[model samples]
Target chain A: MSVLLDPFAYSFMVRGFWVATLIGVTCGLLSCFVILKGWSLLGDALSHAVVPGVVVSHLMAWPLVVGAFISGMLAAVGIGGLRKLSGLKGDTSIGIMFTAFFAVGMLLISAFPSMLSLTTILFGNLLGIAPHDALQLLVISLFCIGVIALRWKDLLLFTFDEQQTIGQGLSVRGLQLLMLALIALVAVAALQAVGAILVMAMLITPGATAFLLTRRFPAMLLYAALLGGGLAFGGVYLSYFLDVSAGGVVVLLQFIVFFPILLCSPRGMGWLCSARGGVR
Target chain B: MRTPSLRGLALTANNGSIAVDIQHLSVGYSNGVIALDDVSAQLPSGAICAVLGANGGGKSTLCKALMGIQRPHRGSVRLFGGAVNRMLKRNTIAYVPQSDDIDWDFPVSVQDVVMMGRQGQMNWLRIPSRDDKRRVAQSLERVGMQAVARRQIGELSGGQKKRVFIARALAQHARLMLLDEPFTGVDMTTENDLLDILREERNAGTTIMVVTHNLSSVPDYSDQVMMLNRRVIACGPTAHTFTATHLGNTFGGVVNELLKVTGAVAGEGNVAMSRSQLPEYPQ
Candidate 1:
C-alpha cells in the first residue's frame, strides 16, 4: 500500500499522473479514428515532424505549441498533397514525407545542440512536466473531449462514409481539416506525456485494443479511454517505483497489455474459436 | 452557363416533372482521361432509370456527378429545379455508392448506420432525436433488417450489407435516390426484395437511378434504360432503348456475339449471369 500511495504524495508525481491520464483519454479517443481511418502512419509522421518546430520556436521565443501545430499540420497536409499530386499511395507518401521531416528535425537538433535534450524530446521527460504544461494539456484535453462529444455522429458519418457525407451536404473537407488540426493539437498536448517517438502508441494502441474488446463504436471509445487511463496511470506508478523512464514504461505497458488482448479478445483470435464453436 | 439555362428551361418545359437534369456534363481524371463527356439527360419523377454499360462505361461517374460526389469539368446537374448542394441540404437526394467503396469494417451498428441518413435533416449539433430513431427503426423494418439492428455492420452478409445501405437511403426519405450496383453480390431473394422496395418507392413518386450491369433484368426492374459508353448511346423506355444496336455500341463488337450466345443459352436456361463473362470494352 505504501508503495502504491507513495508516488501520489510527491507533487511532480501527481502532476505527471494527471498529465498522463489526460493525454491517455485524448489519445485514446483519437486512436479509434486513427486506426479506423488507417492513419497510424500519419500520426507517427506528424508526431516526429513537430520536433524541429519545437526547437525553432524555443530559439525564437515563440510558443512551442504554435510552431509544433504548424509543423504537424504541414506534415499531414504535405502527405495528403503528395499522395494526390504524385498519385502515390498513402503509405508511400507517409514514408517519403515523415522521413524527410524527421531527418530535418535530426539535423536541426545536431546543429543547435542547445535546443532541449534529444532524449527528452524523443522520449518525453514526464517526471519533469511543469504545472503550466499540465494545465495546457487539461485545456486541450477538455476541448477535444467537448468537440467529440458534441459532434460525434457527424464525425462518425464523415469518417465511415465520406461520399455519403458529401451527398448529404455535410462539409467532409471541413471535417477532414478539423481532424488533421485535432491530431496536431493532440500530438502537441501529448508531447510531454509520451514524447514524439512513442506517442503513436498512445494515439493508436488504446483504440486498437478496445476495438478488439468491444463490438460497438461508443463502447469501443469508452473501453479505450478507461483502458488507456488505467494503464497509463499504472505505468506512471510503476516507473516511479522502478526508477525507470516513465514514457518508456507507459508505452511498453500499453503494448504488453495489447498482445494478450489481441489474442483473447472476442473480436480478435477468440472470434475464430467462437465461430468454430458455432457461437457468435 | 448556356447549358444550365437550357436545363432550367427543360425543367419548366417538362412541367416541373424532371427529377434529375444533367446538361453537357463532363468529368475527367488528372491523367487527362475523360470519364463522362458531354452527357446530357433529363429524367422524370416516379421513374426507375437503369444505367447499363460494360465496366468503365462511366455509369458510376454519372451517378457520382448527379450526387455531386464528383465535380464536373463542364456542365451542370440539377435535382428537382435546385442545385445539387441545396437539394441535398433539403434532404431531397440520397445516394448509395458502390458497396466496395464503403468501409465495412467500420465499428458501427446497423441501426447507427441507418441513423446517419437523418444527419442531413438534423440540427447543427446533429443529435439523433427520438423521431430519428423511430424513422431509422422503420427503415430497418422495411428492409427486413429490424431484428439485426443492433448487430455490428461487419457481421452482416453481403446482401445484408447492401440492404443496410438501402435502408439508410430509405431513412432519408429523399425525393431522388441514386444506387450504384446495389444488386451486386446480393442473393436472388434479396434482389427481388430490393426491387419490390424500389417499385414501392417509385409508386410513392420517388426518382430512382440504379447503376447496374445485369442487362437481362433491366426490362423487368427499370422503367427506363440509359445505355452508356463514356457518353449516351441510347436513352428511352426500357423495351425500346435496350436494343441490340445500343448494347453493341455500348460494349463493342463482342456484344453481337454475346447476343447470339444469349439466344442459344436462353432456351437451355442455365445462362451464366456473371459480369466477368461479359466482353471488356477498351477504355
Candidate 2:
C-alpha cells in the first residue's frame, strides 16, 4: 500500500498526474470529432507545426502557449489554402504544411542552439513541469472541453452530413473552422506533457478505442473520456514504479489497452472468433 | 382540394400559389463549365415537383440553388413569395441529401438523426426539449420506423436509411422538402412507400421537390414535372409535360431507347412499365 501511495507523496508526481489526466480528457473529447471527420492526420500536423511556434516564442520572449497556438492555427489555415488553391488532396496538403513548419523549427534551433532544447520540445519533460505551466494546461483543458460541450450537437451533425447541416441553416464552414481551432488549441495544451512527437497518439488512441466499443455517439464520447483519463492516470502511476518517461508510458498503455478491446469487444474483431465457432 | 391545416400559412393546398419561383437562374463552376443557364420555373404549393434530367443536367445545381448552398451568377429564387434565405432562416426548408452526402458508418442513432431536424428550434446548447422528443417520435412513427429509433444508423437497410431522413424532414415540420435522388438505392416496394409518404405530405400542404434520374415513377408521384437539361426544357402538369418530346430533349439520345422499350410514355400508363423494363440511362 505504501508503494502504491509513494508517488503521490512527491509534489512533482502529483502535478504530473493531474497534467497528464487533463491532457488525456481534453484530447480524448476532441479525438472523437477528429477521427469521425477523418482529420487524424490534421491532429498530427498541428502538433508538429507547433514546434516553430515554441522556438519563435523563446526568441521573442513571448508565452510559448500563444506562439504554439498561433503557429498551429497558421498551419491549419495554410493547409486549407493549399488544398483549395493547388487542388491537392487533403493528405498531401497536410504533409507539405507540417513538414515545412517542423523544418523551419529545426533551422531556427540550429541557428540559435542556445535558445531552446530540441529534446524537451520533441519529447516532453513532465516531471520537470513548472507550476505556471501546469496551471496553463488546466485552463486550456477546461476551455477546450467547455467549447466541445457547448457545440457538441452542431459538430456531430456537421461531421455526419456537411451538406445537410448547411441546408438546416447551420454554417458548416464556421463549424469546420471552429473544429480546426479546437484541434490547434488541444495540440498546444498537450504539447508540454506529451511533446509534439507523441501528441498525435494522445489525440487519436482514446477515441479510436472508444469507437470499437460502442454504437452510439454519446456512449462513444463517454467511453473515450473514461478510457483516456483512466489510462493516463494509470500510466502516470506505473511510470513512477517503472522509472520510465511518463508520456511514453501513457501512450504505450493506451495502445496496450486498445488492442485487447479491439480483439475482444463485441463491436471489434470478436465477431471473427465467434464466426470460427459458428456461434454468430 | 384538401383544406390547408392551421400549420399551413398563406400557402394553400393546390391553390396555385407558387411555392418555388426560379427566375433566370444560372450557376457556373470555376472551371468554365456551366452547370445551369437561364433556368426558370414555378412550382405550386402542396405538390410534388419532379425535376428530371440526365446527370449534369443541373438537377443538383437547382437543388443547391433552392437550398441557398450554391450562389447563382444571374437571377433569383424565391420560396413561398419570399427570399430563399429568409425561408431557410424560418426553418421552412428541409433537405434530404443523396446517399453519398452522409457518413453512414457514423455512430449515430436513428432518433438522434431525426432529432437533428429540430436543431433550429432548440436552445443554444441544442438541448432537446420534451416537445422535440415528442416530435421525433411522431415523425419516426409516421415513417413506420419507430421500432428502430434506437438502432445505430449504419445498422439500417438502404430503405430504412431513406425513411430515417424523411422522418427527419417530417420532424422539422418543413413547408418545403427537397430530396435529391431519394430513390437511388431503394427497392421497388420502398420506392412506392416513399412516394406514398410524399403524396401524404403534399396533401398536408407541404411542397416537395424530388430530383431524380429514375424516369419510371416520375408520373406516378409528381403532380408537376420540370424536365431540365441544364435549362428547363418543359415545365407543366405531369400529364401534359412529361411527353416523349420533352423527355427526348432532356435526356438526348437515351430517351429514344427508353421510349422504344416502354410505349407508355405519358400519363398514368407510364407506371405500366416495370422498373427493370426501362432501358438504363447513363447517370
Candidate 3:
C-alpha cells in the first residue's frame, strides 16, 4: 500500500494527476457528442491538425496552445471546405486534411531542429506541465463543460436532427461551429497531458465505455467522467511504479477497461451471458 | 364534414389564414439539375395539402424551399403572410423529415426527442420548465408512445419511430406543419393513427403539407392535392384533382399503366377504390 501511494508524495505527480483528471473528465463528456455525431475521426483529425499550429507557434514565439487551436479550427474548416468544394464525404475529407497537416508538421520539425522536439510534441510532457499550463487546461475544460451544461438540449437536438433544429428556429450552423470550436479547445488543452495522437483515445474511449454501461445520456456523461478520472488516476499510479510513459499507460488502460465492457455490452454478448449467468 | 371541437376553435382563432404563399419558386442543385421549376401554390389554414409526385419530381425540393432550408433561385415563399425567415423566427413551422435522415443511433430517449420540440417555445439558456415537461408528456401520450418514453430511440420499431417524430411536431405547437413522407414504411395501424392526428391538427386550424407518394389515401386524408413533375402539374381540391389525366401528367403514364395493372378505373371514387385495391403504387 505504501508503494502504491508513494507517487502522490511528489508535487509533480500531484499536478500530473490533476491535469490528467481534467482532460479525462472534459474529453469524456465531449466524446459522447463526438461518438453520436459520427465524428470519431474528427477528434483524430483535429488533434493531428494541431501539430502544424504548434510548429508555427514555436517559430513565432507565440503560445503553443493558441497556435494549436487556430490550426485545429483551420483543419476543421479545411475539411468542411473540401466537403463543399470537392464533393468528398466527411470521413474522406478528414483523412485528407489530417494527413496533410501532419506531413507539414513533420516537415517543419525536420527543417527547424532546434525549435521544438518532435517526440515532446507528438507525445505529451505531463510531469513537465508548468503551473500556467495547468491553469490553461483548467480554463479550457471549464469552458467546454459550461457550454455543454448550459446548452444541453440544443446540442442534443442538433446532433439528432440538424434540419429539424433549424426548422424550430434554432441556430444549427452556429451550434455546429460552437461544437467544433469546443473540440479544438479541448484538443489544445489535452496537448500537454496525452499529446495529439493518444488524445483521440481520451476523447472517445471513456464516453464509449460509459455508453455500454448506461442508457440515459446524462448518466452516461457522469459515468464517463468518473470512469475517465478513475482510469487516469490508476494509470498515473501504475506508470510511476512500472517506470513507463504516463500518456501511453493512460490510453492503454482505457482500452483495457473498454474491450471487456464491449464484449459484455447489453446488446452484444451480455444477452447470452445473462441467460447463462456467466458474467455480470 | 367533422365538427370543429372546442380545442380546434381556440387553435384557429385566426381563421381564413393563408399559411403558405409561394410564387414562381425555382430551386436548383449544385449539379445544375432544376429540382423545382417555377412552381407556385397557396394553402390556407386548416387545409391539408398532399404533395404527390414520382421520385425525383421536386416533391422534397418544394418542401425544403418552403421551410427555407434551401434557397429559392427565383421567387418567394411566404409563411403566415410574412417572409419565411420572419415566420421561422416566430416559431411558426414544425417539420418531420424522413426517418432516413435521422441519426437513430443517437443516445436520446423517446421523451427527450419529443422535448426537443419545446426548444422553439423556450428561450435559450433557460432550462425546461414545468409547462415544457407537461407539454412533452402530453405529446408523447398523444402519440400513444408513453409506454416507451424511457426507451432509447434506436429501440423503437419503424412505425414507432414515425409516431415519435409526429409527436415531436405535435409538441412544437406551430401553426404550420411540414412532413416529408411520414407514411413511408409505417404499419397500417400507425398510418391510421397518424392520419387521425393530422385530422385533429387540421380541425384545430393548423396548416399541413405532407409530401408522399401514397396517392391511394390522398382524397381520404388530405383536403387538397398538389401534383408535381418538376413543377406544379395540378393543384386544387382532391375532388377535382385526383383525375386520370392529372396523375398521368404527374407520373408520366406509369400511373395509368399501374391503374390498368391493378384493374381500378381511374375516375370518381378512384381515391377510395385505389386505397383498397392498388398495391403497385407501394407507398
Better model by TM-score, 2 or 3? 3
Tens-digit lDDT string for candidate 3 (A124-236):
88888888778888888888889888887788777778877877888877888988888888888777788877889988999899888877888988989888888887888
Candidate 2 colliding pairs, count:
0
For the candidates in turn, chain A alone yields TM-scores of 0.94, 0.96, 0.94
CA lDDT, candidate 1, residue A276: 62
lDDT of 1 by residue, B149-192 (tens): 99888899989999999999999898989898888788989999
lDDT of each: 0.81, 0.85, 0.83
Q: Give DockQ for candidates 1 onward, in order.
A: 0.64, 0.55, 0.48
lDDT of 2 at A195: 80
DockQ value for model 1: 0.64
Worst ten in a row by lDDT for model 2 chain A: A271-280
Interface RMSD (Å) of model 1? 1.7
* lDDT by residue for model 1 (A1-280), tens: 6766999899999999988988888889888888988888888888888887888777887877888888888898899899889988889999999889878877888888887788878888888987876787788889998888887777788888887887678888788888888888888877777888888999999999999888789998898898888888989999998999889898899899999887777667775556464334
* Model 2 segments more than 4 A misplaced: A275-280, B1-14, B261-283
lDDT of 1 at A261: 88
Instruction: Go through the candidates in order and give the clash count of each.
Output: 0, 0, 0
Q: Candidate 1 — which pairs collide? A: none
Q: Record all residue pairs in model 3 with backbone atoms less than 3 Å apart, i.e. clashing.
A: none
Q: Ten-residue segment with the worst summed lDDT in candidate 3 chain B? A: B3-12
